[model samples]
Target: MEKSNANPSIECTVTECEYHCQDQQYCSLDSIRVGTHEQNPTQKSCTDCESFELKKSY
Candidate 1:
């Protein structure tokens, strides 16, 4: 998919994520990796965005 900031569908609150755009309100990546850390997830906290990359800037 073409990366565009015009799409105002996804709003990322995690500014520390590298996939997040410079604005810190949108995701640059076309898709995100979502998986659970445990064998069987029963809570929302158990899930993680595996595609999340730490941002070098603050």
Candidate 2:
């Protein structure tokens, strides 16, 4: 899918995400859910984008 507007405030590089802007490093959604897998998150890697949805292949 082609996205017309990229949420400039949310910069994303995960192309596999359905909400990611195809042509730019940005997310199409205005807001995203953020979560952590570790009980005590200490770094950025511990956090995850809970809103990420894998793009469907046709």
lDDT of each: 0.70, 0.89
- For residue 55, give model 2's deviation from the true position in Å: 0.5
Model 1, which residues run further than 4 Å from truth? 1-9, 22-24
Model 2 ranges with Cα > 4 A deviation: none
TM-score of 1: 0.70
lDDT of 2: 0.89
TM-score of each: 0.70, 0.89
- For model 1, how does the per-residue alpha-carbon lDDT over 1-58 read when each residue is reduced to its tens digit? 3334523555676778766665648877766778998998999899988878787665
RMSD of each: 3.2, 1.9
Best by lDDT: 2
Q: Per-residue lDDT for 1-58 in model 2, tens only?
A: 4465799999999999888887999999978899999999999999999999898751
Alpha-carbon lDDT of model 1: 0.70
- Cα-based lDDT at residue 24, candidate 2: 93
